[model samples]
Target chain A: MGDYFVLAISSIFINNILLAQYLGNCPFLGTSKKMETAVGMGMAVIFVLVMAGIITWITNTFFLVKFDLEYLRTVVFILVIASLVQFVEMFLKKSIPALYAGLGIFLPLITTNCAVMGVCLILVNEEYNFMQALVASFCYAVGFALALILFAGVRERILLARVPTPLQDTSIALVTAGILSLTFFAFKGMV
Target chain B: MAKSLTQEFVKGLWDEVPPFRLVLGLCPTLAVTKAVENGIGMGVATTFVLVFSNILISSMRNVIPSKVRIASFIVIIATFVTIAELLMQAYTYPLFKKLGIFIPLIVVNCIILGRAEAFASKRGVFRSFLDGLGIGIGFTLSLVALAAVRELLGTGSLTFWVKPIQILGPSFKPFSFMVEAPGAFVALGLMLCIMNLAGRK
Candidate 1:
């Protein structure tokens, strides 16, 4: 129980998926311009990541390892994620139209989000059992969301600042992210 | 059409250079570029996968149904990525360990899939190959440049292969921060700003 708590905390703060691990950066920079979109994307990522983590872990443990097809994990995991995203998209579109509309294009884009795939890969590489993988994946998604929301808030503030022309859009955003990452660094060694 | 092939190839070098202009594959661009060797190793591995996958996807573009094209493209890209991972592990053991998960993460690098979806699927096999080569080289160049700055400033020296050559004076104190996560963003951000400023002229 304590191990899970530590794992969750470490994943969320110290080993943040976006800031430290550098996964899911495309959306981190892209969808983070607006707080609403950031929250929506965050929810979507959390959903997909946790689900993908569990499914991939089950398949990896039961099917791949059993069959000695471990080398095919990358291909298999990606295909699973792609299909899972598609399934989630359809299910949301039908069951929760508001969320489906809110997420919009970003939903489909989640298929390529490295964070989801990264979590699955990390679960396998770290050799986590089922429960640990579940907790870690959820926490990683939370960490990604935490960073995105905070960065979006920072970017929102930066929009008002008189920035230079060359560093206007992504350049400045990246610098802000750098600063944010540095701030996150303060949380290091806490675990 | 023949002339356009050269145009497609040339554009990725500067006009559509990745992680800077396209901003597609920032994950690996930021993650593995702390050192020059890792940057080159990653860039070359990605290039190998991109070039081959582009060709393979281009050739199969006709047979693959449009509905399932993305899945097919991913499978093809994943195969090449696996090949790159295995090859790197065999020959470049140390660099392989340095890279770790980012190598396999190349499958989701976005540049590869972006090229497949944007350029490869619509073009002929030969043209797709050129597009991949151009973008791959461009990405490699940008990554190496980023890695060079980080290594020099962060460590006060640049390492090639296993040997470390001191570039800065012995009295120089390395910034250290320039090689960490935040430094990657700041360095790439500043570089982008410079590139933008230069391109305006």
Candidate 2:
């Protein structure tokens, strides 16, 4: 139990997926401009990340490892993720129409987002068991959502504040993201 | 045709520089840049993948159906990425380990896909080759520049290879913060700001 707690806190706070691990930052900056979009992206990521994490783990253990096709991990994992994302989009649209309406557009984007792929790779590297992988994946996605939402809030406000002409859009967003990442460091030693 | 190819090549140096100007491939840009050596390793690895994938995809552009072109491009990119990974492990094991996940994650890098779809698919093989080379070098330059700033401030030294060459004397206390996770963002942010300022004038 204590070990699980540590993993949760560490993944969500200390070694956050976005701030600390530097995964999934492309969407971190792009979708973070508006709060709704950030929220949408975050939900889509958490939903997909948890499933991908579990699915990839099983694939690696039973399929890749069994065949000693470890060299093809990159190619295999990507294909798995791409197909999974496609499947999820179709299912969401068919069964969960309302929910799909919200997360539909963001779904395709998650296919390419590095956070999902990065976390899956980490899951393999860490050699975590099934339960641990599940927990870690969920927490990491939560961490991504938390950071994205927080950054979105700050960015929305920064839009109004008077700033230099040159540092208008992406330049300023990056600077703010840096400060946000700095604040996350406070979570260190908490676990 | 010759002038245009040169123009295409030179454009990636400044006009469409992968990280700075194009603003694609931020994942690797932020991660794996803690050391100058890491930056070079990453840049070279990415360049290898980019140049080859562009050439292959460009040549096979017509055969790839438009509907599945993105998928085709990804498969092609992933194949090269795997090749790059194996080559790195065979030659530069330490740097390979340093760049671990980010190396495979390169398959999803926006810059590679962006160039594949935007430039390579529509252009000639030679033109795509030039485009990839130019952009790859631009990406390496950006990585090295960012890595230098972080490593220098974070450690008071620059590491081109295994050894750290101390540029700032013994008395200097490393800013340390610049090399940490947060420091990558801050350094890149400040650098982007500086780029903007320079571009304006």
Candidate 3:
């Protein structure tokens, strides 16, 4: 139990998926301009990533390792994620309209979102068992959401400030993200 | 198609560089560029995927159903990525370890997919190949440039292969931060800002 707790805290804080591990940053910047989209993207990521982590872990343990098809893990994992995103989208649309409306636009984007793939790959690489993978995936997804929401709040404010023309959009945003990452780096000592 | 073949290739070097102009593949741009060798290795690996996937997709552009085109494209890209991963493991194990998971992450690198969807799917085979080559080089240059700044400033030395060569005076203190995670974001951000300023002229 304590190990799980530590893993959760470490994944969420010390090694944040977006700020530290540097995964899933495209969406981190792309969808983070607005608080609404950031929140939506966060929710969608948590949904998709947790599912992907579990599914990929199972697949790796049972199928890939069982048959010595481990070399195909990369191709298999990507295919699973792409198809999983599609499957989730279809399932949500059919049984849960309200939820689908909330997450619909973000689902397809998650297919290519490296955070999802990264987490799945990490789960297998770290050799985390089913239970640990669940805990870590959820925490990492939460961490990604945490960073995105905070960054979105800051970005909304930065829009009001006067900035140089060249550094206006992504330039300033990245520098801001750098500072944000520094703050996250502080968490390293705590771990 | 007013642009000449050379122009198509040249544009990616400056006009449409993947990381800077298109901002397509930011994940790898920020992650693996702690050193120059890793940067070049990654850039070459991505270039392989980009060139081949573009060739395959462009050649089969007419046959793939539009509805499932993205899936097919992904499969094609994933195959090349796997091949790249294995090749690196076999021949460049050191780089493979340095790059680690990122080598596989190339499948999601947006730049490759962006080119495929926007350029290759609609273009001739040779043109798609050129587009891929151009973008790949552009992406490579961007990584090398970013890695150069970080490695030079942070460590006061640049690495070639495995050895670090001291490039600065012995008295120089390494800025160090430029090579850290936060530094990557800051360095890339500032570089983009500088590039914009330079391009303004």
Where does candidate 1 chain B have its weakest 10-residue lDDT segment?
B1-10
Per-residue error (Å), model 3, residue A7: 0.1
**Stronger candidate by TM-score (1 vs 2):** 2
Q: Positional deviation of A21 in candidate 2, in angstroms?
A: 0.5
lDDT of 3 by residue, B19-52 (tens): 9998889999999999999999999999999999
Candidate number achieving the greatest TM-score relative to the actual structure: 3
The superposed Cα distance between candidate 2 and the true structure at residue B174, in angstroms, equals: 0.4
TM-score of model 1 relative to the true fold?
0.97
* Model 3 vs truth, CA RMSD: 0.8
lDDT of 2 at A97: 99
lDDT of 1 by residue, B102-198 (tens): 9889999999999999989998989999999999999999999999999999998887677778999989999999999999999999999999999
Tens-digit per-residue lDDT, A135-168, candidate 3: 9999999999999999999999999999989999
DockQ for every model comes to 0.89, 0.82, 0.90
* Model 1 bad stretches (over 4 Å): B1-4
DockQ of 3: 0.90
Q: Write the per-residue lDDT of candidate 1 for residues A1-191, one digit (tens) a residue.
A: 99999999999999999999999999999999999889989988888899999999999999999999988988999999999999888998899998888876777889899998998999999999989999999999999989999999988999899999999999999999999999888889696
Write model 2 residue lDDT over A4-122, tens digit each, in one string: 99999999999999999999989999999999999999999999999999999999999999999999999999999999999999999999999998999999899789999999999
Best of the two (1, 3) by DockQ: 3
Global lDDT of model 3: 0.94
